[model samples]
Target chain A: TQLLEQSPQFLSIQEGENLTVYCNSSSVFSSLQWYRQEPGEGPVLLVTVVTGGEVKKLKRLTFQFGDARKDSSLHITAAQPGDTGLYLCAGRANPGGSQGNLIFGKGTKLSVKP
Target chain B: DAGVTQSPTHLIKTRGQQVTLRCSPKSGHDTVSWYQQALGQGPQFIFQYYEEEERQRGNFPDRFSGHQFPNYSSELNVNALLLGDSALYLCASSFTGTGYGYTFGSGTRLTVV
Candidate 1:
């Protein structure tokens, strides 16, 4: 089975602090997506990285895809209370692969206190 | 336009009972996918439907099955429920053949007693 390992299962930081969450896998992916989920709600797409070594920024959140397409990271700078949520990273298997689903990591729960 | 919609926001069932969850895809979407999410875990894909056919499925067993309608809506049915089946069932919709357009519903919280 294709697995994505996410680190720092839980994180709590004061406002203005910065934090980073990492997702790694041994298998290559055709694309990697980052999502943020609030309590009692489904995950909302944050960004998608399709090319290796690619980086995309959304306000204070920065996402990067590894050069090998087997890893990705989400970095939040000057975090605020609104940034607190469960962050997830999911990878789509390479086309025609046995795994056709979007394999996800357990996720990183972030709490930014003001 | 309205986003993906799921019915029966919450459900409680006993073991061995069968349950069905429904989903209506977002406007302009023709594909629907189902996922299971345990507490504190990311969603795991159960299957995907397009063109009123099962296009792909994950590692779930035959006890979990689904169907798609001509209008692109879908239904997920689970038989012989177990305690392990308790979780949030999520439905996502997107245009077929796209990798990034998935929009998920709020999810139905299922509890198997």
Candidate 2:
């Protein structure tokens, strides 16, 4: 079974629409990371949120870590065609003085139509 | 400096044939991790190597083995490859520091016929 699950496996929307992808898990994590991948490249780290209930904004993207540290969300405002790609969520448990290994979600495929 | 890089961008092999994949971590990083990703799915961790020694490993079978060099580059060898082993192999590098930022390579695509 997938330790972390992403919702709405696929999403397609017109330009300028708002969208949000959810990542949920039963296990608590010290940090959750968000990444975006193009067609042929590997996943690139977008941001890392350490504290629970933390919210970070990356231009049109807003990332929030759940208060319980067991879930996270990615909201994009005014998504453009350039945003079309696979968005992934990864979690790292026992962050503070431990080894860094990430558990990934299945990922949400998104498409923005112009 | 360049980011993490993997070799043999794409390869095709038949069943029972062994294959080797190589990876060179980014500058200033010491830890290396390997993951296997099938189409339309998330990556599954294979193992992690540090100081030329394996520090952690995943649930992969013995068919998957790896070695780390003094320069921090790594090589993954799959013995008695099976058709089920066809997937994209990715190498990620991370420094066990404050950031410990894990940077991934573009990946090497291996197809077993």
Candidate 3:
């Protein structure tokens, strides 16, 4: 079974602060995706990184896929109270049987206080 | 366009009772997947359905079953519910040829008493 380990299980920072969370695994993946979920709601996709050493940015969030495809990271710049939520990283196995299934990390819960 | 939709936004069931949850895929989507999310934890994959068949499943038990309809809608049924089964059930939809990401529904919150 593949497992994704996420660091900084909990984060609390003031507005304007910057933070980075990581997801690591021993197994390689075809792609990695980042998601943000508010309480009582399902996760919303933030970005998908398909290539090793690839980086993608969306507004104040930056996502990076590792060179080995076994790790990924999300960095938030100028965090705001609205940016507070649970951040999740999921990985897709190489295409094959049920490759559509996502292996998710425990997630990083962030709270940005104004 | 509407995204994935799940029914029974909240449910409370006694142990050993049976429950069935429903999901409708997003427009133009052909596949549906179910997940279980415990409080403060990430969602865990339960299974995926495509073409009215079970394409893949996760480590869940047989008590957890699902069915997909011709219209790409799906149902998840759980039998002899245990308190451990209490969690938020989420449904996600995606097209076969589309990229790896999925569109998720708000989810159904189940509380097993």
**Maximum-lDDT candidate:** 3
What TM-score should be assigned to candidate 2? 0.97
Please write out the lDDT profile of model 1 over residues B33-102, one tens digit for every residue. 9999998889999999988889899889999999999999999999999999999999999876555748
DockQ metric for all predictions: 0.54, 0.57, 0.61
Rank the models by TM-score, top first: 3, 2, 1
CA displacement after TM-score superposition, residue B54 of candidate 2 (Å): 0.7
Whichever of 2 and 3 has more TM-score, that candidate is: 3
How do these models rank on DockQ, best leading?
A: 3, 2, 1
Q: What's candidate 1's i-RMS value?
A: 3.6
Those runs of model 2 whose alpha carbons end farther than 4 Å from true positions after fitting are none
In candidate 2, chain A reaches a TM of: 0.95
Off by over 4 Å in 3: A96-99
**lDDT-sorted candidate list, best first:** 3, 1, 2
Tell me the number of clashing residue pairs for each predicted model: 0, 0, 0
Pull out the clashing pairs in model 2.
none
Give the fraction of reference interface contacts each candidate recovers. 0.55, 0.37, 0.58
Q: After superposition, how far is residue A105 of candidate 1 from its true place, in Å?
A: 0.6
